[model samples]
Target: MILTGYLHQQLAAAGVTRAFGVPGYFVMPVWHAFRKDPQIILARHEGGAAFMADGYARATGNLGVVLTTSGPGVTNTATGVASAYQDSVPMLVISGQGSPTTFGRGVFQESFLLDRSASPAALLAPITKTALEIVAPENAAFMIDTAITLALSGRRGPVHLSIPLDQQQLDIPVPPSRSASPPTVGDVPAAPCVLAAAELLRSARRPLILAGWGSMLARAQPEIARLSTQLGAVVVTSTKAVSCLPRDHPMLLGHFGPGQRSDIAQAVSSYQPDVVLVVGASLSRYYANPLAAVLENAATIRIDISAEQVGFRMRADIGIVGDAREAVSALTSAIAAGGTDTAAEPDCSAAELVSAFQKRAERAALRQKPESHGMPSVAGTISRLSRMLPPDAVVIPDAGNHWLDTISLCRAGRTGGVQLNCGVGAMGWAIGASVGMAMAAGQEGAAGRGPLTVCVTGDGSMLMHGAELTVAAEHELNLLVVVFNNRSHGRVRLGQRLDFDREPMGTDIPSIDFAQWMSAMGLRTFRIDHADQVDEVLAAALATRGTVGVEVLCHPDEVPACLRGWIED
Candidate 1:
């Protein structure tokens, strides 16, 4: 069998049915392999291809495969691949390199002869878990298996494989074998550590649980829920892990840190948990800094699959290195074995805590009257759209002020429904990611003829990868993109206004006629301006078939309530 055929077979056996890539002469063999087997979704740019694969992996919990040619193709994918790396998404990137025979010669798109730094494998090594260059056809199988294994191992991330065009096209006799299994790091934590953690939880009157993206990736929601319920502890999720539990859960205290509502902040500070069980979370500044001062006196027990990450960000009194699900399950079992007693007369019940938090949030929302002198307020628009969408629909918010606004207003109703590249803070991610997410949802058939993705991106972000809308139109995907057209980099301008108190330059951009542009590409387009028109325009866009774009003309000066809290202070 040909090497390409064997690669296809291995990928199929590993449950990879779909891939994303841009076509190039060097990667023609990859196209041939994917022609009839694993379906390949075409992208306008290699970066978009990488983002699509990243989104597919995040949405499906499967290995996302992306193929591209060498040189510019690989370099173009750097940003998306870097985002996946930072977010710890498992992805396999296969790049077609120059023929093995022409190693010294400057073949087309050959990076080695041009510059060593330009080599795909060399450039991706820093970002990917592992980057391998296939020098021989016979090494393809081993390298492929290794790449896949590394991708699924602890601290999962992207892996790169630079295969020469000749190697990819070679016909090699290979023995049939099963796909490589994901690496299994032993789940058993040191018995003493587990006992100590249990004891800490048992002794603390107020205990809290912090869940992160690792919890979601490990599917530890059930264990997390059980542990939180058993201990009567409040659960606070990172922004990326907002979907780990339903927003309506009684024990959920809402997302932690700078963007938290006043009610949540007051409750957390007033309650002042004595112990915090940090599970599968990085405790990075983005999620944990604001709570750091508050949790300074709390005993912290951190659990993570990566040993290096266990105590890297926060001081951990007890650092347990193991899979999130297994570690949480073990702790739960240990607590039960220890016969830990529940509080008879606690300071407050979980129900009471939740009620107080909700009351505060309601008060805050009431105080935040729509400030739309004429145009639609961003917060109001997001709130309305959140209510209009189905409970299971997926929402991918791009980076910038819009991301902060959307997260502040939108409640993620379904587990694992909200996907964001908060790790890299990359703009233009949501557009390509939405395409991949919609495809994954469509393939799953769970949405059932309804729109699967609603992407909220700022105008600056939309313009970067807006061309991918053609891909959605070409595939006839049920996707709706809502662009906040503020005609400037709203985040930058806001920062300048607050920090310098001067007119901003380079932040402002010319307003593009997005509705006309989308319509020209065979998509339904809606132009929204006034606050009163949001509901009608959104409803109409949702009802339309295939791909639709809704451009909301927004005021550049308007900032979300959450942002105002920090800016004013």
Candidate 2:
């Protein structure tokens, strides 16, 4: 058997029923195995394939798998892999490479695949917990196991197992254990530090919880909520962490980003609790803006899986190096043991906070309307799309101006609906992710439901990997892809329009017929030129079946939702 066969078996045993990729000569052995496996999903672009894996991992919490050919194939997927790594999603990326014999000789598409693995791997390493390459076939199982262990370890993330083409072909002995086991989480120490931290929370009258991406990774939401309710803490989020708590949550403060609720900021500023508990979120200036100065006097407790985060820029009174999920559970148990149950819930205050924040959001949306000046604005467009989506539909967001705009218009949560580019903000991520989300939803099978997945993207980013549209049609995925046709790089346009004082440059590009392209792919398509046409087209697209796409042609000058203040006058 080729090592590829053994790798396939290992992945199957690891519960990876699907692998996504584009095939090429360098990766033929792995591709052959994938084809024979009857489980892999062959995608059109290497980037799209990786994103499919990303969506799978996001939906199932299982290790998503992706494969690619060498050089350009692998390079094409760097952004997607990096996004998975950054977001700490568990993924296994196996890219075929030039045989070790040609690695340094520059034999056709050959770069330093192994020696230089650490460089790109380093970039991903900051984002990922571990990365490696397989030099020999015998090392395949070990590397595979290692990748799984690292990916599901302290901070789950993407693991690269770069296998030379020769390695993929070489038959190797099976290791005693074929199935990869996730790494074991070490015992979290609940020392005097945790006790003191508990005391801080226990004593605080108005405690506020700021959960970040780390908290979600730690599975700290339930525990954090328990602690917050007990302590009367207001819970807010960093930009990417909006989904950790329900946006409709009474105790939930709105997201911390551009166009965020002014009242949430005011509440945070006004309530300025004596104790601030930050779990898994980096204590960056993004969340602590204007409030950074206020943090000087407040007691801070930071717990994260990444050691670097514990003392990155700010000093924490209590810092722990345990896994976030474990640490939170331990902290929650300790608080519970301390007779921390409070019969009096802060329901009334939470309701007031949510109401105040919504009012501010409404006012801000109104303020942005006048700035549109007849152009189709991102904020308004997303607002329409959000309403058009079914109550249970999954929204796939890629990274770019359009994605940022969608965030402002919609609310994402673990309870479902919005799935964002949380970790890495990978561009060209939406189309494939939409397919994955659609597949997952279709598997659930509810009668009378609309399209299960909706993808909102920009024209420029869509072109980057637009070929994936064919894969969606081929897979018979019922996905609704909405393109914001602003006829330019929306982000760059925003930058040029704002930074250059309205003398925009290098941002304008001629629009291509995206809807036509999708239609040619044998998928249903719709084109809309104005904001008024969006809801109607969206309704029709959702009503129609089997991967319908809508293109919204808008003015290039319209600013995205969050950047209106900075990007517009």
Instruction: Tell me the TM-score of each prediction against the true structure.
Output: 0.93, 0.87
Candidate 1 ranges beyond 4 A from true positions: 113-117, 173-192, 340-347, 366-373, 443-451, 566-569
Deviating ranges (above 4 Å) for candidate 2: 35-38, 101-106, 111-131, 178-192, 340-351, 362-372, 413-416, 422-424, 440-451, 564-569
Q: What local lDDT does model 2 show for residue 561?
A: 62
Local error of candidate 2 at residue 321 (angstroms) = 2.8
Residue lDDT tens for model 2, 448-510: 244477788888877787888787787677677888777888777677657876766776768
Q: Pick the candidate with the highest TM-score.
A: 1
lDDT of 2: 0.70
Scored by Cα lDDT, where does model 1 land?
A: 0.80
Q: What lDDT score is found at residue 547 in candidate 2? A: 73
Would you list the clashing residue pairs of candidate 2? 207-233, 218-325
